[model samples]
Target chain A: MKVRVTVMLKDGVLDPQGKAIGHALQTLGFDGVHDVRVGKVIELDLHGAGEEETHKKAEDMARNLLANLVIEDYSIEVVS
Target chain B: MKVRVTVMLKDGVLDPQGKAIGHALQTLGFDGVHDVRVGKVIELDLHGAGEEETHKKAEDMARNLLANLVIEDYSIEVVS
Candidate 1:
């Protein structure tokens, strides 16, 4: 089975990297760009797990290791 | 308008960060985890653009500055 996790910074958190990217885009002449927030995605392939089990395990992974809970939020999807 | 870009490393590319994350997850006792790959998402809020224009600009942003075309693939979505 395949599990996909989307992790994103919580609102109100300072995202310097995102700010830098936005600035860079503007400098590159992409003036249409405004607010930019950057997040991450983690894809995992697991063997010997059903959909329910895979999602539970992936959720645990996200909570315990994949994301900083106080600053980031994560959602898991069973992709396959 | 809101646009989102998902950037991912191409298959066969070495992802040291992903490897480290997987190793860490294993260390944390999530033994079900395997084959972890990490990517990124960028959300952009733009004003004064229609869906077509927003998507086009976001695609250009991804192709030129948001992602490395040689090693990564990017997809743009009009979120709002």
Candidate 2:
């Protein structure tokens, strides 16, 4: 099975990287862009695990290590 | 309009970050995890642009700045 975890900055959080990216886009002539929020994705391939178990494990990973709960949120999906 | 860009490392590319994450998971007792691939996601909010234009601009960003063509693949989706 394969699971994908997406971790993103929470609402109202200050994202310097995202601000920098937005500014860079404007500098590069992409003036239509309003805001940019940068996040991360993690893909996990597991063997001998059912969909439920895989999702559980992935969610655990996200909550424990992949995300900062105070500022970031994450979602998990089973892809295969 | 809102656009989401997902950037991932291409297969066969070495990902030290992924390896480190996998190792950390095992050390933390999530031993069922096999392989992990780390990627990135960028969310862009655009004002006064149609869906087609937003996607086009996002694709341009991915190609020129957000992703490295040599080792990464990116997909752009218009979410709103």
Candidate 3:
């Protein structure tokens, strides 16, 4: 099975990197670019796991390794 | 308009951070977790832009600020 995970900064958190990019975009003539929030996408390949088991495993992967729980939240989508 | 951009490491590139997470997931008892590749997602808010303009602007943003062209590639989706 394959899984895709997206991890994002929680709302209300300051994203310095995103902010910098927003500013840079304006400088580069991309008018009207207001705010940018940056997050992460993780793609995984798994073996020997069913759908339910894979979902659980993907969640565990997020909670334990892929995300910083204090500042980030993650969602998983299974493909194939 | 709103745009979502996802940036990912090019295939065959070494993703050290993702590899570390994959190892950690195994340690945390996530069976069948094999390979992991990490990427970035960016959400943007724009004003005074139409869909075609927004898509072009978003691409400029990606090329100028959001992605490292040497190691990463980005795609954009417009919503709202």
Candidate 4:
């Protein structure tokens, strides 16, 4: 199974990298852009018995290794 | 409109960050994981006339600023 984990800064947390990207975009004349948030996407290829087990393991991985519980939020999806 | 841009390293490119994450996961006892790849997801809030224009603008942003053409590829999506 393949799982995708998306880790993003939680709402209300400051994101300097996102701000920098937004500023650069505006400087480059992307006037329509109002806000920007940057995040990470981790794609995992797992060899597991079933989709349920894979999804559970992916979630555990996200909680334990992929995301910081304090400032980051993570979402996991089992991909085909 | 809101747009999402996912930028990832080219297939043949080496990703040390990804390798480190994979190794860390394995060390932490995620035995099911076989392979891993890391990428970026950028979310943008755009004020535009229509979906098509917003999508086009996002593509332009991805090409011009978000992705390194030589080693990275980007995909744009008009997110609700």
List TM-score per model, in order: 0.94, 0.96, 0.91, 0.96
- The sequence of per-residue lDDT tens digits that candidate 2 reaches over residues A1-80 is 99999999999999899998899888888887888999999999987889999998888889999999999999998999
The segments of candidate 1 whose C-alpha lies over 4 angstroms from its true place after superposition are none
Ranking by DockQ: 4, 2, 3, 1
Off by over 4 Å in 4: none
DockQ of 3: 0.84
Candidate 2 Cα misplacement greater than 4 A, ranges: none
Interface RMSD of each: 1.2, 0.9, 1.2, 0.8
- Candidate with top lDDT is 2
Each model's DockQ?
A: 0.82, 0.88, 0.84, 0.91
Q: Cα deviation in Å at residue A44, candidate 1?
A: 0.8
The pairs that clash in candidate 4 are none
Candidate lDDT values, in order: 0.90, 0.92, 0.88, 0.90
Model 4 lDDT at residue A26: 94
Per-residue C-alpha lDDT of model 4 across residues A1-80, encoded as one tens digit per residue? 88889999999999899999999999998897788999999989999548898889988999999999899999988896
Clashing pairs in 2: none
**Candidate chain B TM-scores, in order:** 0.94, 0.94, 0.94, 0.94
lDDT score, residue B47, model 2? 91
True-structure RMSD for candidate 2: 0.9
Q: What is the overall TM-score of model 4 with all chains considered together?
A: 0.96
At residue B77, candidate 1 shows an lDDT of 82
A67 in model 1: Cα distance from truth in Å? 0.6
RMSD (Å) of each candidate, 1 decimal: 1.2, 0.9, 1.5, 1.0
- As a whole number from 0 to 100, the lDDT of residue A41 in candidate 4 is 95
